[model samples]
Target chain A: MLRLFKNKFFLLLLITVFIFILMGVTAKQNSKLNWFSNTINVIFSPVEKFFSGIGDKIGSGLSYFGDVKEVKKENAKLKSDIDKLEKDTADLERYKQENDRLREALNLKNQFNQYDSIGGNVIAKDPGNWFDIFTVDAGTKDGVGNNYPVIAGSGLVGRVLNAGFISSKIMTIIDVDSTVSGMLTKTGDQVIIKGDLSLKEQGLCRMDYIPTDEDISVGDSVVTSGIGGYYPKGIFIGKIKEIRQTNNEFTRYAIIEPVVDFKRLEEVFILKNKNVGNTGTDGAGK
Target chain B: MKARNIVFAVSIFIIVVLQTTVLHYIKIFGITPNIMVVVVIGIALLFGNTQGAIAGFILGFCQDITFGKMLGFYALAGLYLGLVVGIVNKRLYRENILVIIFFTFISTIVYELSVYLVHEWGMHLFSPENSNNLDILYAVRNITLPEAIYNSIISVPIYALMIRINDRFENANKSIRKY
Candidate 1:
């Protein structure tokens, strides 16, 4: 046994077996890190955050120089747009009060809007191109937890995969492993949006299970149906980009152009359900 | 020797931090060069199999913990890569830039393909969706080839730096031995 241990090839084989075993054990979704990994994360989070801040500053600084003329033109355009939006907001506020009164009369719950959200910065991304997982600066300390729905400014990003002490891993919607229950905003048809390995390079997702007879067209919006307990209802996913016919004529899949610019993603918001206790199958069914 | 080990360990940590944070901004075609693979190759070429393997394992483990869905996949890839490169260390001209670049390009392809295979196998075992040969062909053309090219280009400066550091450590060790 001592001589076998001394043999380099034998030692290599042992380590290989050990690692394979470790992979098997931790292959499941939402696997908690051991003490060693947790400790490393605890130490690495702040450092990663600091470096990410510097990188962000450098990136913006470089872009600022290159796009100064364009920025000024865009700024003037945005000012007019803001003025128009302010007038629209005033009209919407009056409508909102009337809607609130009607909702109170009907005793209907505001299913999507009743959640607390914590903001986080993207500190680190997965080192390889194979996965779209990233580390965010929010953790359980900030009331962020596993399976919390994360979103960017434009639309749905993904959900928290694992929450550490001061950092959480987010699996974005473009990752091959990600799947969300979504619906067409125009026709109210339920569809499954999943990440495909080939499409991930283009920062797009695959929307599958569309009924043949559904009048779904390119540019129709898709949102969470709230059927999956993970995401709340009515969160904007993306617009259909292209429709493709499957081998089975009854079903088709469409490519989705996600509204979030995932490559340039810097910040995100993780939504925490206020009524956490009642987030059961009953609510999912509705 | 101890100082060399410390420097290697610290450099690995720094590489991980830089790869995750700073490297994301510098992506070409939505893919960052795998700097860890370059560094592992550098170590294996400079120090032989044992050190190379150890470096690969450590780097792989760090990546697996931080970003991987499975704990040992990267670790396994890194370990084998380091071992294989280290085995060839004895016969190669370590100072030749082209040789290093060629090694890095090939190693990255092997590393990424192994990762793809393991992931596909896992998907086959656990998930309902089975990836077909088209997906494999697409991955090789789009992902593996571009990544390998990127890694090879970036390997030049990184390998040079590793050579300098290794030379400095060896000279210091020689002086100590003489004393």
Candidate 2:
């Protein structure tokens, strides 16, 4: 064993294996428990948040011309109204966004009245097309913790993965690892809403365990059933886009398109509900 | 040695930020290249097994801290990848760009698969619905393959940066010896 330690290859393997074992055992705990991971989050979260700010600016800057073209196109569509409403159009557009935000806040506040929320800017995201996971600027200082339900606008975004001092990692609903208990709003059918890696690009998920006689169909809305105690009841999950009935017939599932557009998401809300148990969310390595 | 360590640490830090912030916006075939993989491959190919393993571990750990909740899966994958690639490159010459691209591509695939196996499929037995819908082929086609090509594309510039940094370290060592 002593001689084997001298072999650099074996030494590296031993070191990695030990760390992996330690991590695997603690994977379910508060992620901030690891000092090293916490320190990294502290150091990088701000830096990431800073870059994300710049990223948002740069994205808007680059798309400025596209926005202009859109305005021009809309101007043509409402040419008669444009003559009288041209100046107000700009203010109207601005108000439209503000109104949308206020409406979202109002809806979120009303729906999750029992839960308190800490709003944060989305600082960083997974590099890949899949929004299975991403990072946010808020952390433990903001009272966010593991498995806290996250929301954007009116839709269910995801849950908190790691809540650091200055930042938190969010696992988006469209990720393969996330599984939420959902109910079909119209028919009250219970099903499992899960992130499907296959449908990730389309910003969709798969609904599992749909009974053949649940009176479910395309366009049925799905919301959190609150069975797991991690997420509260009645969080809007998504709307069903399609259904896939397998040969087993027992393995029926539906494709759900998440309302939260992973592409344009810039900010999100982290819910701090008092009555919830500790649950863990983890994402795959890219 | 301290300065070299700082250089590696700083580069990985910047790469992690870019991976999450800037790289998030840029996508090819609906996926962004694994930039950290390119950086690790570059370090491994240029710096030897020791530095490669350490760099990979740090990079992987940072990635986990930034983008994931589970801490050490990526760290272990990175450490092993660095070691594997670093040792493998000992037999090949870095003068050939093709060799780096090929090896980097393979390394990226291995790393992606390791994550999928450890993180995704580890709980495969519990989710029977997912068990029947095997997605290895889908994952390979959609994620790993596109990422391999993307990593290779970025590996060229990372290789140049590695060569320059490696030379600087060697020159600094030489100057110290002369003094």
Candidate 3:
């Protein structure tokens, strides 16, 4: 035993087994970070946040010079868009008043009105290409918890995987491990929005298990079905770009162009329900 | 020895911070070079198997804690990578640029393959869906191959830096021993 203990190869083998054991222990979905990892994350969060800010500044500064010509064209386009939007705003105001009246008469709660949202800056991204996980500069101290839905300016970003003291890890919907129950905005048909290994490279996701007889078509919008409880209902997911038939012939999957520009994403909002435990049941429960 | 260890720890921390923050902007075709692989191989070649393995473990642990769903996947991969590189390079010339580049390219592929195998096939830890749904050919063609090429290209400068740091420490240690 002593001879084996002194063997370098033996020691390496032992360490490998130990790490495998550790992996098994922590691989569960509900596993919490050990105190050591939690402490390290707390210490590193501020440094990461600082460096991320500097990186963003440098990126924007470099892009500003290259964007001069494009900006001029965009400015004109935006002016025209603004003129069109001004006319639509009046019609939207009347609709908003009617919507408010109908909601009060029906005694129905607003889809997202019951939640309080906190903004977070993305501090870092996963260094590898396999996963679409990123860290946000908000945590338990800021009331951000696990499974909270995250969104960018345009649409749903993902959900929190783990929350530490000063930071949290978010697994974006484009990750292969991620799956969200989604619904078609037009046909009210249910589909599963999943992160595909191949499709994620194009900054897109796959919507599978589409209903066969539905009037779903390209350019139709998909939103959260709110079935799995990780996300609230009616949050915009993406627009279907292409529909591909599977080998089974009965099933089909559509490519989704997500609204969130994940490549340039800098800030996000985490939705926290004002009344705790009201968002839905825990994911494991479902 | 203690001072050298401290330097290694600090450098590893700095590399990780830069990797996650600034490295995102420099990605080519959505693939970021795995500098951690290059650093581990360099440390193993410059130092010994023990030092290489320790460095790899530390770097992997940091990544696992920050970015991984599970704790030990990267840590285990890194440890084996460092140990294998350090042991295999014992009889080879370490200073040759071509040899370093070759090793970097090979090690990056090995590292990524092991990660994919474990995450996608072996454990099925992260992906809740069936593993068959994942296309391995796509992963190799798009992710592993490009990453290996990128890491090899960047290894020249990084290996040079590692050599300089190793020389400084060696000289400091020699003077201390004389004293």
Against the true structure, whose lDDT is highest? Answer: 3
Ranking by DockQ: 3, 1, 2
Writing each residue's lDDT as its tens digit, candidate 1 over A1-286 gives: 7786479878888898998788876765444444456567888889899999999999889998999789889999999999999999999999899877854554434665778888999999999988899999998789877778899984999988777778988999999878889988766788989888888878899998787789988999988888768787777899999988777465778999999988888899998888763332232233
**In order, what is each prediction's RMSD in angstroms?**
3.7, 5.5, 3.0
Q: List the per-model TM-score of the A chain.
A: 0.81, 0.80, 0.86
DockQ for candidate 1:
0.71
TM-score, model 1 to reference = 0.89
User: What local lDDT score does residue B136 receive in model 3, on the 0 to 100 scale?
Assistant: 74
Candidate 2, residues A81-157: lDDT per residue as tens digits? 76668788888899988866854653433446667888988888875443468878888888887778899987899
Position B101, candidate 2: lDDT = 91
lDDT of each residue in B18-131, candidate 1, tens digit only? 998999788888778999999988889888877888899999988987887778888888888998998977647988988998999999998898888878777777765634
Candidate 3 C-alpha lDDT tens digits along A77-124: 999999999999998999999977854564334778888898999999
Candidate 1 scores an iRMS of 1.7
> By TM-score, highest first, what's the ranking?
3, 1, 2
- Give the top-scoring candidate (TM-score): 3
Off by over 4 Å in 2: A1-6, A66-71, A76-111, A127-131, A248-250, A274-286, B125-133
User: Which residue pairs of candidate 1 clash?
Assistant: none
Please report how far candidate 3 places residue B112 from its true position, in Å. Answer: 0.4
